[model samples]
Target: MATQYANDIPFSASHDQQAFKLLELPPELLSLLESEHPPTLTITSSKATETTSGYALLCHGDKKYQMRQKNTSNPIMILAPSRTMPTESDDAETFISSPSVTTISKIEDTIELILQEAEVKAAPKNKWHEKFAKSRAEKKK
Candidate 1:
């Protein structure tokens, strides 16, 4: 005979969905994250240009990858776990068994990363701090 566990909780999905986007990490990113010491990743976007609106890029140290926004028909949901506490309203000996989970949000699209080439890197004005500092120095002069 199999034993039944009494610690089962309920799960629910929220009708109201929050706005959220998911970034699909590349293989190189996965390896970097799995490494002993992971480097911080930065996401930077370009200003609107005459030819194009703009684009985003993800930076990993010296290397950079273009971030492309893509839409999908499939919905991706983000779930949140609900916490429980023992109730003593009737005092018949009731306790919270397990944590219940709920769906908190749904994602509309995903961001894909593409490795940026040397020529591609030259276009956008990056290293924002350097530009700001140079402007300040020029103003001071």
Candidate 2:
């Protein structure tokens, strides 16, 4: 059976997703995860086998891991794994997992590509009129 690692923690404002940071994984997994194609995250959920409650999952590293979210006093350090557990276990648990390197890098690249395109499209049309106006006003003051 394929293993899984996942967490359902809610994302916070400080969750700064960036591309270069995504490279910090095992090189082969990193290469596999970050394709030039659009990346997609597959989330799954199901009812607990015994209880009426349910759990959520996010897949990374060819494994499916459970997930959860926590509210903390600090803002910047939000969305940490509730707990880190090795794959060997009997009962079910909840926690957050890091994004796979491929997922992270692909996302980062897509965002950068979009931003670059936007900058190119907007740069010439605006002609820096607003920027120049602000600069002239500042000089006068």
Candidate 3:
């Protein structure tokens, strides 16, 4: 393999860090996304209860997939590149152009989707009697 090296160009990290999430889509999820008019997916977390620590899930339509964050030893960075135009020097004698890249965000972990059973569960029944419930009827005088 031939190796070529280019001159070092300056790259800077942004002052403000924007935390980014990396999601690894599974095959089932990929197919859903490729289909026409893909359903909207949402990330939701369950409230922490006495039995379980809060867990997150990726919801696609009525289907829900368990989302797990796996930490990585190396950090993944998202960068934006720009080519700066040549500007006049302090002495106004020369023009300097710098092509640079900026690190806009960093991701340390990735979210993995665990495929859950995609069963079409029955729609939930609404308790109409519970809402606007009637008070107890009065006894006969």
Ranking of models by lDDT:
1, 3, 2
- lDDT to native, each model: 0.80, 0.41, 0.78
Which has the greatest lDDT? 1
Clashing pairs in 3: none
| lDDT per residue (tens digit) for residues 15-72 in model 2 | 3544331112334434656777523545577446565576665444345444544333
Q: If both were scored by lDDT, which would come out higher, candidate 2 or candidate 3?
A: 3
Q: Which TM-score value belongs to model 1? A: 0.58
lDDT of 1 by residue, 34-100 (tens): 8999999998886787898878888888878888889889878798987654556644465545678
Q: Which stretch of 10 consecutive residues in model 1 shows the poorest summed lDDT?
A: 89-98
The alpha-carbon RMSD values of the candidates against the true structure, listed in the order shown, are 13.0, 22.2, 10.0
On lDDT, the stronger of 1 and 2 is: 1
Per-candidate clashes come to: 0, 17, 0
Instruction: State TM-scores per candidate.
Output: 0.58, 0.26, 0.63
Per residue, candidate 3 scores C-alpha lDDT tens digits across 1-141 of: 544545677778888979788989988789879999888988898567788797887887777888988999999999999655554544444646578898998899998988668655769988776553543222221
The C-alpha local distance difference test score for the whole of candidate 3 amounts to 0.78
Positional deviation of 9 in candidate 1, in angstroms? 7.6
Model 2 lDDT, residue 86, Cα: 36
